[model samples]
Target: MSDGIIGLIGIVALLTLLLLRLPVAFAMFIVGFLGLWIVDGWNVAAGLLSSETFTLASKPELVVIPLFILMGNVASASGMSRQLYDAAYSLIGHVRGGLASATIIGCGGFAALSGSSVASALTMGKVSLKEMERFKYDDRLSTGSVAAGGTLGILIPPSTGFVIYAILTEQSIGRLFMAGILPGILLLMVFVLTVLILCLIQPSFGPPGPKTSFSEKRRALVGALPILVLVLVTIGGIYRGFFSPEEAAGVGAGLAILYGLFTRSLSFSALKEAITDSVVTTATVMLILIAAHLLNPFFALTHITETVGNFLAYLDLSVLGTLLFILAVYLVLGCFLEGFAMLVLTLPIFFPVVLELGIDPIWFGVLVVLTLEMGLISPPVGINVFIVKSVAPRVPLGQIFRGVIPFWLAMVATLGVLIAFPQISLFLPNTMFN
Candidate 1:
């Protein structure tokens, strides 16, 4: 009878739909529109739906989605991602577990360019998997490293995850982008260490790759320089306050296109394909965001965020304790839900609670994104794991999952370190911009 009860039922039904294989955007749309109509009336629901869809559709900030995606798609078409991976591999592949480390580093570099975990995993897997196979690297370590490393795309700058979080929470996209840098690098280092530890324990898991001659290393670095420069230009420009997030996206996309053409790598057909892919990806993201908007108002009508905030305060947990509890919930939910789905479902309720506790929005965004990264590699529905599986079909799904366990622990450690010192997430944003 109460709005709260109605909201609860709607959430349950939404989850049921998801379990029944409904698309996330449509499921949210159906439940959100119906719940709003039930809570208010058909007229109000119709007005809200029409207005929200148009507003989200026309948002200037949304342009970043397509542009960043285009930059990545074009980069993939141009072989820029492979060049980056080759550069990393040339430098580190000779060391024990070095190939895996190179894969992680390559994933991080590609993450900076693409900002999509699926893109990073798919691209890097195509580039690195065969090489690792040639080097006799264990399929588990090779596939696991690719899957786990790809999760960096969410935390690295130019990330769609940060973009979506910024739009949803009304946080500063540039600041959130800056905030993610150190944490992203930290996580990359942790993953490299995980590879080292795994190889140290079992010497053959990731056998050393062939040593490259100094000339080969130099050539590889030269080949990747264009991408490295592009990454620095876009992310560094934003950090320096020389460009807004949208402008940065435009600049990055333009540069990606020019690079592809100048290198004679992206033909007209490939360029068209890149544009089509970017459009489709951007459209999917926009629809999900619009659906989230619908559900958000319905949740507000039920006072769920307020209710949850009140309950959190009633418990009187210390700020750290409360934060940990929230993250634990994300960890559990990650097993069953896709990362963006979890973000849309939970942020409306939890973000307000985070602010009430006086946490920094930028810092919290990094933490939340990192948790989402965990979910991307989490079991049952680890989307990145599945992406890697698709790339290396010969490797059993269970073995890939098993391989991710060490990297998953590495993620847990990274989370703990960030939690212990929030400045890890905050320092770059504060120092570089403020």
Candidate 2:
């Protein structure tokens, strides 16, 4: 059989494994290893396995993953996330649908610290859901806001999603980080607007919360100050070229630990748990990266990426049409596949087409990440919906799914805006780097 045919078979096998509910890392590893052995030889396959694994494991840039994860874990364990929520609530809780809006704003702040949708959703859900319930906010709106807002974790600065995309595409992590800023803010605003409109339409969906006095607002903001400063320092330091992304991560992690210790909010046991969680999460990400590296070489050997790129080129679509087509595929895959799995599986095939079409990689990275965010709240496999359900167990899964629909549509609108105005994604990076 032709190598291309072998590649196609390998892809089918990989998908079969995934559909069988095998772990993503293992499924990719199996497909990559076997495909390499079949198309080249066992020796080449074995050599790549060892080398790629070591190469990814020891890479300095990847240290950002563990460090940023640790920062997030420490922040969550130490009540920084709670402080952020409290601050947001104090500032906005008096408005109609204020509680849900506050939850989204808090989610955005926590996302900056955590760079994890699951963490953002879980932490904010724990902090805000009970409070919203106390205030009689509708479960659909409350749960929906958390699910939708948590997705911001992947699009904001220090995002693990961007890091993975950067590694896969060999783009500058800093540039990608910068590129995500404006688009992230835009999505956050869109989410808040969705909450406002929902509350306006139904009124009962979100009741106006009690207005806090200025003193109370100041106190809440003061409580959240350390995290706010940490975010600025790490992200700003990167923008200013004072440190690389890895250094910024280390600094953020160290500061988070120090703040927790200083405030006596992070006990020895909590700190230990944070470390353990960070290690486990970091290991999982590394394994996936290594597996992707292996899988990419297999595709290269089979010339699958080239063949796919050629096929797309022959379609004679406008650049915008081609871009939209690829994004549509992502939206479909997202319904069934986990976000990271979908990313690793498809980027090798689609990214070359993106590059060949002269689409800016950094801008494309932002667009791709935004689409992944939509997938997080999309039905069936909506990971963030599931995360929200775990936190708000009394709420029906169907309710949470219903809640996320409006926000999902809001995301769709935001995606359209970003596509129409690519400058929204590119402006920050261009201004900062150029």
Candidate 3:
């Protein structure tokens, strides 16, 4: 059989394995190894395995993934979640829909350290969902806010998705990380604003939270000083050439551990939990990475990417039309594929199209991140929505899915803003790298 037919068969088999709830890594590994064997016998496929493992294991930027995951787990195990939520609440909790706003901002902050959106959703949901419910907030609004906001895990800096993209495309990891910053922050603000507007139009959507006194708000601000410093230190460190992505992750992890120890939050059990969480998360991610490496060659063999590029060029679609087409495709795919898999599957096809259209890779990276982020909130395969559902089973799964509507609107608006004004996505990377 032709390589093209074999590759297409590989794709179907891989997706079927995933649907059967086999581990994502296993699905990819099975299809990848089988495809390689079918195309080039067991001997050649075995030859590449050792070399592929060595190459992937030694990539410098990948070190950042574990460091950031460790930092996030430490932050979660420590009492940082409350501090983050309280700090946002101190500022916005008085407004109608304030808890939802706090939830959005809190999710963003937590996700900055987090590389996994499901973890972000579960963490923030556990921390804030009850409080939002206690205040009689809309079930859909409260649950949906977290489900939506948690997606910032991959949209913000310290994003593992950006790291994977960089490694896959041989783009600059640092630039890709910075590429996420402005767009992520823009989405955060849009979510908060969306909540504010919802509260204004329908105050019952969120009851106005009790106002806090100035002194109490002051205390809350003071309490969050550690995180603010870490954010500044890490981001500034990256911008100043003081550290590379790996180094910054190391710094962030150390700072988190130090903070945990200082606050007596780093008990032996907590340390074990953090290590376990980081290990599992890292293993899961690396499994996908390895499988994707095998799968990528399928596209390379079939020349599918080049074909898509040629087709797009033949269509002679305007640059705007092509960009919108890419966006629409990701939005639809996001609903089905988990973010990492979605990225691996499409970036090969889509990156070529973006290049053909002369779109900046740095800018397109951010755009893709934001677009798939919505998938984490969209049903019937909304990963983040499921994460929240796992945490708040009392809230119907349907309600959490419905809840993401406003945040979904906000995500689309943020994407529009980034698309309309490319610099919002471009400035940080250009400034930092240039």
Pick by lDDT: which candidate is best?
Answer: 2
lDDT of each: 0.92, 0.94, 0.84
Candidate 3, 1-434: lDDT as tens digits: 77777777877887788778787778878887777888888886777676777778888778888998998899888878778899999899988999998988988888877766777788989988898888999898899888988998888878888888888778988888788888888888888888888888888989978899999999998987888888777767897788888899999999999999998977879989899989988888887887778777767776667767777788888999988987898898777777788887778778877776689999988888888788888877888888888888888888887778888988888888888999988888888834
* Candidate 1 segments exceeding 4 Å error: none
Candidate 2, residues 185-214, lDDT tens digits: the string is 999999999999999899999999999999
Steric overlap count per candidate: 0, 0, 0
lDDT of 1: 0.92
Candidate 3 Cα RMSD (Å):
1.5
Model 1, residue 196: distance off in Å is: 0.7
Q: Which model, 1 or 3, shows the larger TM-score?
A: 1
How much is 134 displaced in model 3, in angstroms?
A: 1.2
Question: Model 2 compared with the native: what TM-score?
Answer: 0.99
lDDT of 1 at 342: 84
Candidate 2: list runs displaced more than 4 Å.
none
Looking at model 2, residue 413 earns an lDDT score of 97
| Candidate 1: residue 368 Cα off by (Å) | 0.2
